[model samples]
Structure formats: structure tokens, C-alpha cells
Target: PGAAVVADAGAREGASKCPFSKENMAMEGAPTADGLLAGERYIAMNRFQVRDGSEAQFEQRWAQRKSTLLQLDGFRWFGLLRRVPPTGEAPDFEYPDDYSYVSFTIWETKKNFNSWRKGPAFKEAHGGGNIFSFVGMIVNGFMTSKGPPKPAFWRSMLMEKTSDEKPILRSGPGGRPDADGQQTLDPEVFVSMNRFTVAEGREQEFEQRWAKRESKLDGLPGFRYFQLMRRDQTPDDDVNYISMAVWDDRAAFDNWRNGDA
Candidate 1:
């Protein structure tokens, strides 16, 4: 073994630059560069201040009705998420659970959502509501070429295997960062998840390259953490890996997205 060490040292010197680094030089986690997802768009909906006691009833109702919304033309994908709390406390996070429950549904067009909102189905599923009743909705504008402009919590309570999917149901506690209440997230947390596909034969290289790039990111201030996760038990067509990152504030997140930081 000792003699083999000398032989191995003579065999290869330093680690070679990731062999597959040349495939796509765009930003590490940018989603638009991948071919399969180019035309796809994202829509995010957030419902806040859900009443503590009514959480069960609220989920029951949404479960009963979510499938109907998917039936609408142009509907793409959907997710329901709860916010995570921060490390210490946030100035804006007033209520115990500042973010409780939210439903994010993606569609093919703004027109698709508009048409559905005005139709009877939308009204029945999500049209009129109040936070006290454990119901609320905030529709974000379409996701353009730029990914999320700021560091914010975005997760898939239910992610699909194929483009056409029937979301399998899962259960959890409240949203918005809070202490151990079945569901927990940090307070100063501004988190977001972006999905990407590594080009064929480039997976190994991409991992090596990201390891180097992420190491440098730690030197910057307010950078909390970055994680790369691949879905488990996923179908063949759904090979998208996720990158979830945390930051101190929106300005810090925006700086990274805008290339200023």
C-alpha cells in the first residue's frame, strides 16, 4: 500500500478541471438554459394568515376542489406550500405563523388564469375568501426569463412526475417560519427552489464545478446556505434536480439575481 501511494501519485497529479464544465457556461442554477423547460412558465399563489383552528377544514376543501381546477384548459402544474420561519426574528413577521398555507398553480397563459378566474369553477374553488376562514390568494406575475428576483420561500408540497400529473396528496403543519409545530422554517429565511436538468454526459462535471462555485459564495455576507437536491423515487421523465438557497434579506437575494453581488 505504501509503495502503491508512490505509484498512484506518479499516475495522476492534481484533479483535472471538471471534464464536462464546457457544456453550458450560463449561471449555475439558471433554469432557462435547459432545452426541455424553455417554453414552460411558472405561476405562484400565496394564501396567508390562515386561521389556526380551521387548518384542517381548509385543507379538506382545497383537496376536494384542486382537481377541478386542473381540468381547466391550459393548466400546467400546481403546488401548496407553507412558509418556513427564520433564524431569530424578522421585523415583518408579525403573526405567530406569518405565512400559513399557500396554493401555487401554474398555467400556460395569463389569459388562461383570467378566463378561469371569471368562470364558475374558479369562483367556487378560490374566488371569494378571507384569512379568518383559512382561505386567501395572491397571484404572482408570470415567471419570465429571469428566475425569482428575490430570495423567498418556494417549495413543492406536491411535485409531479410528468408534465401531465395528478398531484399525490401529502400532509404537514402550518407555514411561515415558526418553532416546532409539525412544520418549521427559520425566521430570517428567504428561500427559493429552482429546477434544472444537466445535459447528457455532463452530470459529473456539473457537480464538480458547482462544488467550486458554491465554496466561493460562502465568502459573501448574508449568504446563509445553499443546497442541491435531486428528487427521490421519481419517474424517468422527471429528472429535474432542485437548488434551494437561503439569504438574509431580499436585497441580498436581488443583488445575486441582478449580478450586482
Candidate 2:
């Protein structure tokens, strides 16, 4: 553990001399030293704000869909997450959940996403959507969306996997139960993500600060996973990045926040 801390510090200092700043790092194909990501693992999430009482229908929409993601090349992981509310007077979170749900997906590279968009799989995936269904859903107030979807894409810079994924957690339909298709809702997993827009030209310094900062998240109870990532944007665009953590449950996160860690 101490050795890891030392190595992380050394990397923080050495990154400036390594010639690859987060800005200049190449973002393409797998497991190589590019940016923070050892490989070209890209993440995409579409946040959707489902109106009150439409949550079930919203989730069912995804659960009932015919997925072609597995058949596509470079598709890695996917998860449909629902925001969890605080339990039993856990002093309300300073900031409440943003969107009601997020469709999280991982790809081998940015190119793979483009390929999927142009290929037949993408078309087939949306083949069932028609104006009639859209009109009906809107008119019937079924699964009404609160707002337009907000999409965010990122390249992972760091991650800590505390438990075995066997690929990923209880996500979409036909999930890892392996026997019965009917899996329980979202498997006690809670995702906490924060967005950061660093000052211009301070991207490297910001990243270094994160690399060197001391954190006691390693062995925190119920901590399952964590990742620091930089979003895809123009150099002049806001230097957006995200720090995402996955816990055994929301209560676990609440404990960490309630405590000093």
C-alpha cells in the first residue's frame, strides 16, 4: 500500500517530464500508456431525467429492448442506473441526484462508437421507434422525459477495482445471473459521479494534484470501484473531467461522506 502511494506520487511528478500531458495524449486503441487510461477504454453516459412515476416504465423500456451491443465490436460494459434517495434521516445530501437514470456504456475506442453508428446494428437497435409510439407515449404521459438527454463521454485516467466484475454488475436484461433472466433491480450498486471543469491550461496541474493527493478510499467499507476520467472536448472547450465512484450501496457512500474519508 505504501509502495503504491509512493509510485503514484512519483508518477505525478514524472508526468510533466513524460511529454504526454492529458491534453496531448493520443486516445485510440487499447491497454497502452496514453493518458490516465492504460488503454483506450472510453466511457459514454446518457443522463435522462424521468418524470415522477415514470421510473418503472423508463427502466422497462431499456430492459425490454433488443440489445445489439454485445454483437458490436469493441463494446465492453453497460449499466442502466436509477438514482437512489437517502434513507432514514441520513441528513439530506448537500446536492441531490441530478438525472433520474443514466445509461452507461463502455467502448474499446472512440472509433468503435463511430463504426457502430454507421453500421447496421445501430439502425436495427432503433428500428422499433416510430412516430406513433412516440406520440402515444407523449400523449399518454407514459415515461415522460423531464428534459433532453445529457450525454457525456470520457477517457478513463485511473481506476481501482476492489471486487471481481466477471465483466460488469447487474446491468441490462440477460444480465449475469446466468440462469434466470429475471434479476433483481440494480444489485445494491450506487454510482456517485462529480463533474469538474478545470481552468484553462491548468488541466495538467489539476490532474497532477489528483494524482498526488492522499485519499483513504482504498479499503473503505463497501467501496467497490472508482475512476477518474477526462471528457472528450475541444482544447478550447471546457476541460471537463469526472470522478466517479461505485459503492456497494448508497448507504456506504453516505457513510464515507458522513465520515472524514
Candidate 3:
């Protein structure tokens, strides 16, 4: 849905434990791209950078595939976002950037998400009911030579928004992601995110800085939603944080960037 609300940030743990992961990915915060954190609600993204001309094929995989997340607990929202190529670009695109596609998901809690990961639904949604699908693996390697999915996760710190409506789910045929079960987002909406890595031991200081800063985005045109997300971290980890903002379109974002607050 285009509309979203500021969700409550309930009891939080300093260092979240691993729910069911085989190995931790040094995720002491920027939130493990693929990890379990201690929190009430979690946002995760699996970013993919396919070969130069393979974007359509990658999206097709998600569009045609079946996801059983709605049937699983802790699931709240899922969306496939495509990066808008830099403006003023011609046939040859050159931009030092991140993921070309992001598979976004929202969960009620970290534990619930880990549970689903270890459940049969994980296997089923990943194509077939196999732990390691050799066919899928081969295809992934051959298709995404650019890079594999980078998992980035975050816990909602502040959810300032333009609306208070929660995501609405309706009945659909076989509960397909593209069916009429979910609300459609405006085609022009855009999301912009920046990754920050704070020096170790200064995470709290960084957060305090953000909390105390005066933001001028409240009344901006085309602004839809904003979030400050943090990751699970250990003592030795460099704190990672993601600042995300949702706008009406790419032009809106550019306008904000070109103007002074």
C-alpha cells in the first residue's frame, strides 16, 4: 500500500540473539541483510544486481514465482522494487550504485521470521521443496554474474509518515503476490535509501545526533514516508544504519535534492 503509519517501537534488546541462523554475518547493526534481530518489527531487503540486460529476467522470476509468506506468521508486507536508472542517461548507463532490485519484506518480529526461514514454506517459496535446488543455484550463478543478493536488515526506529493506514490484505486466487489480494502502489512512487556505517562504540552517539536534529522534511511535497533503521550488532561490529525516504516519484526526490531545506 502507498499509505503507512508510524508503528510503535516496543521493548527492545541491545544485542539480539540469533534465532535459527547457521552462521551470523558480522551483523552488529546495519542489521544483517539476512539475519534475526531482537525487536517487535523488522524490515529486511535482499538486494540483487543482475547482469546489465538481465533485469527483466530477474523480475520475471519473482513475478511468476509463488510466495507463501502471507500464510506464514510474522509476515506483514512484501514488495519488489526496481531501481530507477539515473536521469540524463542514454543507452549506456554508468552509475556507481547498489542493488538493481530489492525484495522488501516486513515482519512482526525477528524470531517469527527465523521460524519461517526454517519451515517448509521457505523451501516451497524458494522454488521446490528442496534444501538446495541445484537447478536454481546454477541459474542464479549464471544470471547474476554482477553479484549475489546483499541482505540488509533494519529495526524501525522512527516511522514518521503521511498516513496512518495499515496494510490491507484481501482474498485472492491461490494467494498469489500479483493477484487482487494486496493494494497496488502508485506507479510513480519512489524510494531512496542511504547506508551509514558508524564507528564502533559511537552508535548511541550517532543515534542521539539523529534524534536531536531538526528535520525539515515534514512539509515537503511528494514526500510519503521515512524511516530510520538499525541493525543487530555485537561489541566489535561497526554500527550500520539505513536512512530511507519514500517520495512520489524520482523527480520528487531530485527536487528535494536540488533544493535547500
What overall lDDT goes with each candidate model?
0.39, 0.56, 0.56
Estimate the TM-score for candidate 1.
0.34
Off by over 4 Å in 2: 1-40, 85-98, 128-147, 163-171, 174-188, 234-239, 259-261
lDDT of 1 at 113: 58
RMSD of each: 21.3, 13.1, 10.0
What TM-score, computed on C-alpha atoms, does each candidate reach? 0.34, 0.66, 0.68
lDDT of 2: 0.56
Name the regions of candidate 3 deviating beyond 4 angstroms.
1-40, 86-98, 134-142, 164-188, 216-219, 233-239, 259-261
Query: On residues 1-261, what C-alpha lDDT tens digit does candidate 1 reach at each position?
Result: 000000112112342111111221111343332422222333434333344444444343443443366578877655444453333457346544244554555566646755765576654554334211112121111111111111111222222122223233232222222323333332233555565666755644555565455243454554655555432222123344556555566566666666644
Candidate that scores best on TM-score: 3
Q: lDDT value for candidate 3?
A: 0.56
Total clashes in model 2, counting residue pairs 3 or more apart in sequence or in different chains:
2
